[model samples]
Target: MKNDKADFIPIFDGHSLAGWHPVPRLPVSRAPGEPSPDPDDERYRRAMQTTGKWTVEHGAITGRQDPPGCGYGGYLLSDGVYGDFELLFEARPDWPADTGILVRASSLGSQGFQILLDHRRSGNIGGIYGNGIGGFHGINFTLDAKYDEHGRPIGLRLEDPAAAIEPMTPDKPALLDDAATGEQFLSRWKWDDWNEFRIRVEGASPRITVHINDGKISEIDTEALKHPLYNAAAVRDLLGPKGHIAFEIHDNDPGMGEARWGANAACRWRNIRIREL
Candidate 1:
């Protein structure tokens, strides 16, 4: 049966990070036109020192971006790579927090789609993001739109380019139980409680599906990825067929900056499991 329990396997033991590792830091550029810093930069070392903050507590893996100890946040990458699979998990986020799970990620930078766990008025839960590749600015809420072979968004473009910094807006939520629109889904997301999340990915063209709290949210097929949708050329070359799974701790704002999340803006995950399809 589709609802059978044995189809899935636990990836997080609820007590230890036995199969996960902190992602290596990528080179950062201090300013435009300046050469990017080496991977061995001091910032990378400082970031690694903070991995201890990602702790397994009360049967949940919790990440806290506390400054002075760890502020430049990064991803907690899985030691293994995955292709076609369904991942089931739950997350509780502090208001004004930004986090996501990266699928098919490469070590250099997150290379696949990031299911957005953004929890702020300007953010969208269950949004699809092309991490290191594609033109979507990582907050694509419209799902039915199709792209051309060149990656240009052709059929329907739902959102304007995301603002450099998401503006503070009043919290007026809409029902998401049977959400008819992305805005509804965003509104229905539980901000103060744990919410269920799921993702499924498959095929060479890479079709992705996202669900939040058991409500169907977003879906995308990347076969039509084209220019304007992201740098199609760079995506084709950098994005691989399969890679690791990782969780993000977005450092800066616009999404969920350290300032917004505060010194201890926390994001918690539990019941993390995946099943190959």
Candidate 2:
């Protein structure tokens, strides 16, 4: 069920990022965005001049890789921590944008439970992922480009998920309880328009249910999970009972022949509301 707007709290002000901060979500021991000291270091050249930040544009929270095609990625996390709640938002991404929502995210940017919105080639949107808690994926089919004669993406076609998944998420998530077919999702999602998402996350051992345009799409229950690498106890210890809500600006791994996020393309969000349960 949707939360009552009268009782809901606004997560975004619609004018500014008051309680949110951008963090470089890197998979490394070193601090994210810490430029290499030596000029000779290869990582030094990759240091972003002005990438990995979110901004308000035309009354929406917009996220993108800055300077057109720079190699950078990060998360925009809320300041407060929430235990269980229903989150409401609308997303309208460019033809090729790699973005997602995070619940129970760590402020340090390491761990989180993600609702996948990989809107590029060979990607899937209505899936779930264990970010740093455990590297797992939960999606049956991926999406491929369906372009018009103008060489612009018009819609998405379903494909085998094997080629698109990230390297980290090789196994199924600790618990992938329920999901809709890829064909069903494509039929429901409105292309080049805002799609409302209502997410309900509840229980100490959370059961996250995602609804797009008020239609149920997927569910994940981490309770009684038996996956080898996914330890529920360890994850809870790291993130605690309460954690921040975050958003992802996924990397454009140029070296690996991946253009997941289009150059300077943005994912737009609006009407972010939360109702703590």
Largest lDDT belongs to which candidate?
A: 2
lDDT per residue for candidate 2 within 165-270, as digits (tens), equals 5432434532567777777888889988999888888887688988887777888887665565667777777678888998888776755333677776889999
RMSD list, candidates in order: 10.1, 4.2
Q: What is the lDDT of residue 247 in candidate 1?
A: 83
- Identify the candidate with maximal TM-score: 2
lDDT of 2: 0.76
- Per-residue lDDT value at 149 in model 2: 95
lDDT of 1 by residue, 1-277 (tens): 1464467899999999899887543433322233555657766666565442578988988876645224566678888788889888889876546678888877744456777776543456675666656425333343222357995423322334354245322211111112226555745566467788878888765677777776777776666544353544445455567778888776653444454454667788999999988
Which residues of candidate 1, in runs, are more than 4 Å off?
24-52, 66-70, 138-164, 167-180, 186-188, 229-236, 253-259
Question: Residue 133 in model 1: shift from native, Å?
Answer: 1.3
Clashes of each: 10, 0
Error at 163, model 2, angstroms? 6.4
lDDT of 1 at 222: 61
